[model samples]
Target: MKGMIVSRPTEGDLPVSLDDLGAAARERWGAWVTERHTSVVPNAVLTLEVEPPGEPEFTVEVMRGPRSINLDGTPVQNYATAAWLRSLMPADAPRVIVFDDAWSMHADLTYGCTAEGLRAGTVDHSVPGWDAGDPDLY
Candidate 1:
């Protein structure tokens, strides 16, 4: 999910900036900024590589979509990015119920589905983790 800096929490959607999502991913997802490119798309996605223990290290694009953190090969469709982030830790922890205080972490679960161009320029085919021929989002 995306991140935001709100003056006050509103019941409606929170205004999330590209930078906000980047900060949140770095802070909560154990992600390190891999690349910052303007040519990626209108969103100008902030790509981050996550090296979770025991799991294949992969990329997570912050500001990936309207309300999601797009993982490279291991895409998380409707799931909470924060929970998925934490799940990638040394071990998967119990899922936490996301509250209003942390809406960015709360997302629905659509495992492995990705939007077009989500992995456009970010995947390194030379790398072993993302060479699954890619998936066509149905």
Candidate 2:
């Protein structure tokens, strides 16, 4: 019944502005970042780590939503993880699940649903940037 949410920036997408990012975080996590700017790390990439109480560790990334782009390229914006989470959660479930490890410099941001939830249809979402082909991918 517990999990984590992780996020990072994506390439070739609408450069997620600080304001948009803060709004998205507030909507999703109910918390706001006090400061915002381009990450000092090169490549314009960032990882937001999250750890929920008594839940499996997981992560999510901030990429251009699918609707925000076309095969030929164009400007568009769409719901990303929230929609995916809604699809996985039961319609009747109350209280949104969130994580506390919001910012970590060296943390892994890979979302993971509990085994029981996966079996019970409580959490069913595909993880991106994860390759099951590798022996240690999980």
Candidate 3:
């Protein structure tokens, strides 16, 4: 259930400083986020565990770069969770893209967030030789 979260902010809307993005994982994930022992790449990353009570717990590698924080973890299976994730995006972010590995052509898992709202769709994994028509055949 791996995935990538990317956000690109406009020049005029960029945060004044990286520090302006907030300092705590709680700021982004709320009180459910807990610090844990996990190694990350040699970059500014926050390794934490998100345990939302009854829901399955997952690891989140929040990589903060010069502009936005990159969130790496599992994909949301429902629209409620997707909307929650979108709500956490920084105000400077004009568009937020999320790519989920468990996505299907009919699943509304892979999506993007913008002023227009959450735009969800599928990823075209169609390859030249893998055009079998039957999805499972691939």
Candidate 4:
């Protein structure tokens, strides 16, 4: 089902430096990234909208520290797709939450990004229509 994916840094993971993030964005996304915004006063937040050369565009909201990095993109079709999306963030991110309201059960699907690789799990609650898996919602 279509959903929103959010990845966050664990206690052990270091906060990504703004410079490193900027370089990483350029390296990983290059000119494919159409827009970039950063807030540094109250808090450091970097937002990027990436539209690959062709189809399938997405938006990423990155916050400093342990705050969550919300990623709303094309619905993952397979584990590889999920992994690719996860790769967009720092490798230290330990888990990702996938929320899909279309599911009659819980809407959140949690995935652990461990050294052993991604592990899927169930969430206790639901966030109905969180993103409705819509890119335009960004």
Candidate 5:
């Protein structure tokens, strides 16, 4: 049986620092979040990976320079789409709100979904982001 859960800080509730965001996400994601590994991409780009349990994970990647973000991993079936994730994020103070909020995690749970139905896929095969277990994420 395969399953997937996707969640992030609700609107108006964002984290201050990148580290804080990751930690907050880990906690909200529940006990599934295990070890964390940090890998930076030279300057401002960073890639953080939590314990991977051979299941597809939802990832929200923020990049500097142009200051664009990419929500990768997971498919359109099991979890929330990239569009939904971005919309849920706070429009103002994405950083400060996360740290201040209590539970900043939003999940896509389909009621009456069986374990088999929970199996998710990828949104983009050409280029996948971090959480989805795609190498191009970093």
Candidate 6:
């Protein structure tokens, strides 16, 4: 006898911040660079839209993290992350697949799931959106 497994897709929002990402990386790797140090590094906050085979869009944040400077929260689990990515699939889209880090723990579970997609290359990375620049920070 043969068995088959099927998964369904889900839809929701995902929030992310770079504020604690640097610290987290440093904590895990002992050495890490802040986003400000990398020209390619995205802004501190972002909202990613996920849809299988479809381009994802990045929206800027109107407000900063609760801490004002850093974020605080629990990281998303691998299974939950994978489920969220699967939810982004269209009826005919291929099975959602992902493998990456989970850094947006401070973000809601939904957002954390989406972050997985972002890291896994499941979501589009070409969206041109970012928070307004602050001269003081620069």
- What digit string (tens of lDDT, one per residue) describes model 3 on residues 1-138? 445443342333222233433334468668887764335555544555677777766654445453333344434522334444555545554444343434222122223433223334433445344335544323
Poorest stretch of ten by lDDT in candidate 2: 69-78
Position 29, candidate 4: lDDT: 75
Q: After best superposition, candidate 1 residue 33: deviation in angstroms?
A: 5.4
| Model 4 TM-score, 2 decimals | 0.49
Q: Compose the digit string of candidate 6's lDDT tens values, residues 1-138.
A: 011111212222222234443344345324222233322324434221212223222111112231112121122333333344334334444222332223111121232345554434332223332112522110
Pick the winner on TM-score between candidates 1 and 2.
Answer: 1
Instruction: Report the C-alpha lDDT of model 4 over 4-121, residue by residue, as the tens digit.
Output: 4343322433234545656766787789874455644244377667777666777665656625454556544323334444555555544444444443222222233331233333
C-alpha lDDT values of all predictions: 0.38, 0.31, 0.43, 0.48, 0.36, 0.28
lDDT order of candidates, top first: 4, 3, 1, 5, 2, 6
If scored against the real structure, what TM-score would every candidate get?
0.35, 0.28, 0.47, 0.49, 0.33, 0.21
- Among these predictions, the greatest lDDT belongs to 4
Candidate 4 has its poorest 10 consecutive residues by lDDT at: 103-112
Query: Over the stretch 1-138, how does candidate 1's per-residue lDDT look in tens digits?
Result: 233111211222223555665566667654433445343645535666666666556655544332334444343322334344433322322222222223322221222323322223233333554435433210
Task: Please tell me which model should have the higher TM-score, number 1 or number 5.
Answer: 1
lDDT score of residue 95 within candidate 5: 24
| Residue 44 lDDT (model 4) | 37
Sequence-dependent TM-score of model 5? 0.33
For residues 1-138, could you state the per-residue lDDT of candidate 2 as single tens digits? 222332323222332353555455556655322223334434433333334345333333332331121111110111224333433433443323322232111122223433333234322224443434534223
Most accurate candidate by TM-score: 4
Q: How far is candidate 6 from the true structure (C-alpha RMSD, Å)?
A: 17.7
Stretches > 4 Å off in candidate 4: 1-3, 8-14, 38-44, 64-66, 77-138
lDDT tens per residue, model 5, 68-105: 33344544422333333333344543321111012222
Pairs clashing within candidate 4:
none
